[model samples]
Target: MPIPATAPARNTKSDTDPDALSVLNHVFGLPGFRGAQEEIVRHVTGGGNCLVLMPTGGGKSLCYQLPSLLRKGCGIVVSPLIALMRDQVAGLLEAGVKAAVLNSTLSYEEASAVEARLLAGDLDLLYVAPERLLTPRCLNLLGRADVALFAIDEAHCVSQWGHDFRPEYIGLSVIAERFPDVPRIALTAPADDLTRKEIVDRLGLNNAPSFVASFDRPNIRYEIVDKQNAQSQLKAFIAERHAGDAGIVYCLSRAKVEDTAAALNKSGVEALPYHAGLDAGTRARNQDRFINEDGIVIVATVAFGMGIDKPDVRFVAHLDLPKSIEAYYQETGRAGRDGKPSSAWMAYGLSDIVQQRRMIDESTGAEAFKRVSIGKLDALVSLAETANCRRSRLLGYFGETPAAAKCGNCDNCLSPPLVRDGKVAAQKLLSCAYRTGQRFGAMHLIDILVGRLTERVTQFRHDKLSVFGIGADLNEKQWRGVIRQLVAMGHLAPDSEAFGALKLTETARGVLKGETEVMLREQVAGARIRSVRTKSRRGDIAPQIAGSGGAANPGLVGALRAWRSGVARTRGVPAYVVLHDATIDGIATSRPTTLAGLRNIPGIGDKKLEHYGDELIALVKAAG
Candidate 1:
């Protein structure tokens, strides 16, 4: 059903007015708002300040976007990246909204044109970077315009303690101070209690109502693998489910990024490297290709992904552990943004943990900051080593109540391991680390417990000890999991003086003395299967992707993608910017035959329907 043409563009009616509903259906092409979207939109439209913590694909953009159209003046958005601003402005323009961006990348003529639009009150929204927005010249221009509101995206950057802290963001309070009468909104997807409070205080949004949506993204499946055969495991993982799909492979260093990209290319995956070390132009070109092309994976360090607006990223694989839980969440949230199923696959081992801790300990920051960083890393370690549902543990970190006791979407829930009374196992491991002079890391401690008389064990002649070989029952990997869990549980602490050595903490004494009962998740039957769809857990995610022997129509999806690609190429925009694969899934499922039928599809907005309705209907019919 098409939206009635008589619906007004702007309305002064109440919060529950019909005009907003019309815009929701006609402009964005959705049935209605999800979660707190309607409430936030109404508040901002009615001239109230707010802070929104919505997940990816939760339509955070519409909270400020709809208000900009209905309110008194242009919405001034202070975004962090030029790429992000450009993507947003382009999408809004395609939707027939008057949106423009002012950033360094813009040419002189382009910037002047945008300025003319701003001054002429011809634009509904103006996206600008923080540096440009804070300038004296831009401030002067904004003062002259009838500003509707101020929106600060990626608001978490203002927290000095956050992983992605931007010094320039600390000055954004000027938006609230200068535009006293105008409403303001600050938004971020992932922020803990500390980061959230800091964002409010730093952005001067203290009085604004804060709305936090559930942190659980059930559409994304989480899997953490112990780093055995890292390269082959990555290849198999990609080949199994995400073959010829767009994805990201995150590495900890630039050299690793290049090496991983090279390895992936050799293995038949079209891969590219992206990092700050490359020339600026090369980096930009690579980013553009990844965004605009299909089946291309970019191997990058943390330097990428902050301002990325691409939505159809199929997976995010971490070759190394991130600095903190917040970093991991923000990075992995990039995948499956169109609300289809995706995977967050990570390969973490003892070395990753050691390197991370050493980096924190050896950093130039204050001791207080280092302490907080270490605390954050410990939380991530817990998530990786957790025996329960991964979704529950992740959501708990962000202060959201778990959506379900077991999400049935993660590795643990899909292939639950037997939990055993690990009190004795914990005692044996802690005792070995202790009797070995408390200066050995997990490997050495495991070797000692497993009675392996390697060079280190023999050089010290420590194999003659009482605790030696007591843990022979547990294999090396199982013992490693125990040690990792022990460190995460705070019973074992990494000793700085000993250079990544494991040391018994005060909490270890209780475990050794049987005063604390330790429970550990035993290894699954065949964890080292060395395939993409390894074990029973892969079955949980197999149904999401086409050609995985599930219910999806692979041929129909392929045809729709080809059509979307041609349309996107004609418009010179990324394929997802025109239509997401999830929307393609809907078209394939419903097999809509006419323009009227296409209007009922969620992603087919007023502009898209008008532009591509005939071609889409033709394609669907031909496919049938």
Candidate 2:
């Protein structure tokens, strides 16, 4: 492929052009940008590189989309998944942006038509998968086209720390080498400081301005309950608080996904299973239903969510432990994307931690990689076991300290855990682990400590140890909690070489010597009551949302939803791609009666105003 000869510097005439904000308002129907969006836009429009680390639903799309339109030529977007590209293109078209996607799924004629548009400069943006864009054929075509810039969406795919790492993303740096004049912007919804640095290094954006926004998703009420009968707990969580509400229940295995979906179905909640194990067509159809319909719960593995662009997911429940904090953050970020109240509910137990650690220990990766994986898992364990404010701990993980130490939106802040000094308990547990040669897992240690004369205990002759049977005061679950918390707090480390055998770390010395007091939550006896708070718990102040409107008229909201569903079905796209339920709620609540009034609503952009303005106005008028 022939490279284009030296090209002129990218035209910066649009940098000072004031029409960008006007276009944002008139075309996209947004009054203004939020949270570093305007600054990022100006930087990119002035032909500068940027790495945007914004939270999900934080308007990362606008950072690139606006600049692409403000600049002179078509913006090239490199995305990893076909479903994501389709959703983005559909949403862009709804907002009046001329966007097309080129992927392997397209037919010969479809591909030709997209290429024709590209050559004619008839598109504002073109979304292509990284594999497609890295091809010699596509590179040669891009070398000759009047390219504006490159927007690498979900750019964390370049980092191994991210949940959805894609090897194809490694080749995206070519855009920097080849189209040196055009600005490049990389965006991701989740990345820690290390991952952020790796993204910059790997994407060759070392000199680019990095914008790190706050990772606080205050709209999501964080709740992590101890697991006991996870399915029943999840069922009660669904049946009570979120009945008929759209949500996602994530599992770590395909069998669990299928079982959970089946259980929810039998219990009268409409649920679908999604995973790599499902037939491709079935997965696609299930995903399409999830996108287009409302109140359908999807039970899935991690493979189900990164492609979901729908904004109204009311909750995200985890049936098992996520591999890392990054994965947990990204998955929960999917909920409440529209800035509505939602929940990040989870049920975790000692088994979850042991299973996750074992997965890391048994992995074929190098020791360095395994160490990093353990560190990541330990951080997640910390989050799960923390008696502190969930939001504060979560934010602190991302290097942000919230102004308020206690965020009232989380379960810990709402109903504080019963924290007690467990120094004696810790010493007992640590003594039992050490006396047993630190070669036993938590269950074995628990058995040894609790005087359970199991075969292993008799074979190992641990029953006679001084520390053995000394922990009989604490039940099996309580001992497990002590061990798990110690592991999380770094007082204990898992032996990667011995299938997660308990090993005393240096931190354990302080406890054993009584120099450090271990504080722990006293285990209360119950059936592991699901912490899915359906209403205000005892001694909890209700969270105050500023300027909250009265509840919308259900009849009006129902009518508006019916209209949105009809429009989405007609357009052969997801209902959210057509119009989010949040936008429809705004319309129904305000009862706007004219096209001009309807356009003034927050989410009704130019294309929507032009296409659905009459219908919305008519519906609003008739609802009265």
Candidate 3:
């Protein structure tokens, strides 16, 4: 009943070479290729080029990793983050692959040694920073070595349209010109149609087949709460649903990151702040602690992103809005990497829209760039405001054709909001903007419409307008919601040159002329009841930790997790790298007591089985 050592990584490999299966079972211990992984791996291994858009935790690494081992020469992985490189190389080494990293962190001796290894064909994989990889010395060294393929990790950064664009990634196009024969692959977690085109054009992967895995992470429940008291809402959500679980909290500014981390810590949540303002050492320490230590939350800005392989992150909470949907997806996709249920919860409000628009318009970017940014922001805002299924809209933005209108996972799908016809309200708001000469922001315009005769209103003689007191039926908050929804729906826009003035778009003319109808959802009060099926219901995540999950883990999983934690701590690797939660799930459920039983479990390759087989067997026997 044991899985064959030659079992193919995926059954779709009906025509795949058997050696891929051998390397999969003997080296990686995975059952088979997931999604389009088999096709991608085979294509690249057989000397083809590809651009892969797989979601985070969808095993993007394996697409390149398997081929790296199977091909005749070393694989060159151009990555942008140090933490990412470190995690990949470490995980590969644990799997018995000859992996190394060449970064600024290494001393001359270490660099020389790794260079020697590469020249000697001793490494199966080498991760290099984009800046370092593009250097004359590094490129020359690579030109001399036999490279089986070029794996461009985080390939979305090459796109100028993306949120995480890097200038150095542009130079990566040289790979095609230099190693025309070697296979090349570019992969990223999130990219819209435009960004995809940018990656394709900039990276010179024109002829490469694109293997886009489903962007849907069904395990992740998307919750975008109307931002009222975001800090309190965030605290309550954490306390109620994800207490003691490892999570990431993203804010929009350095000051906010520090403040939020301070607040969370003051409230007894173990939290740390991460921003570019922090010293390199502090950032490194905080990041390391957040990764190695369990149940710690890291409040970070965009600077701390692009994943560090801490797979058990249960939630990704956004205290402020990201710039675009690509940014949002990239940040939230960091959660639930291990295929367990997770939450991508966000708190946004009217001010977030104002702030984002101001940033885009006030930026020094070209007119085209600003237009694209505004369009992307508007799409994100639409996602936030829609009464329909959030998942469908989100996936739709990425050009994913939704199979169903409702995903049964997002807050809206679970608890559909009450809708009200806001046609009259929209007319009044747009008329007020027009009557006010479209020269004021939401606050001043609201004051004019609601008839709160302030000094500015009196000075502008806005009290004399016929639209005055027309919206008195709605409170300031309700009116703000209306305006927010209007902006989100593209009925109005911020006047960038006027420094926080309101502007009516052409769409506003339709509303003002009664040519278009409007409906808006009642604003969400707070976080909805946390849903999405995951391991927490069983209290199985690191059993000893308090408030970590529900009741108790039925004996064996707890003991093995405790053991795995100790091993990971001693070995200084992320706990999942030692034995993934899935592998532990397999062992605890199967209760394997023999070497064959252990070997039969996925994630236990020859190297891992040899290293931990006896101990696992003994543990299973004692538990029995």
TM-score per candidate? 0.93, 0.92, 0.92
lDDT of 1 at 295: 86
TM-score of candidate 1 to 2 decimals: 0.93
Which runs in model 1 stand beyond 4 Å of their true positions? 1-5, 11-16, 527-556
Per-residue lDDT over 430-450 for candidate 2, one digit per residue giving the tens place of the 0 to 100 score: 988888888988888888878
Give the per-residue lDDT of model 1 (tens digit) for 319-407: 99999899999999998787667789999887888888889988999999999998999999989988899889999998878856887
Q: Model 3: which ten-residue window has the lowest total lDDT?
A: 540-549
- Candidate 2 Cα errors over 4 Å, as ranges: 1-17, 452-465, 497-500, 523-551
Cα lDDT of candidate 1 equals: 0.83
Displacement of the residue 352 alpha carbon in candidate 3, Å: 1.2
Estimate the overall C-alpha local distance difference test score of candidate 3.
0.84
The CA-based lDDT of model 2 is what? 0.83
Against the reference, the lDDT scores of all candidates come to 0.83, 0.83, 0.84
Off by over 4 Å in 3: 1-16, 448-465, 523-527, 533-553
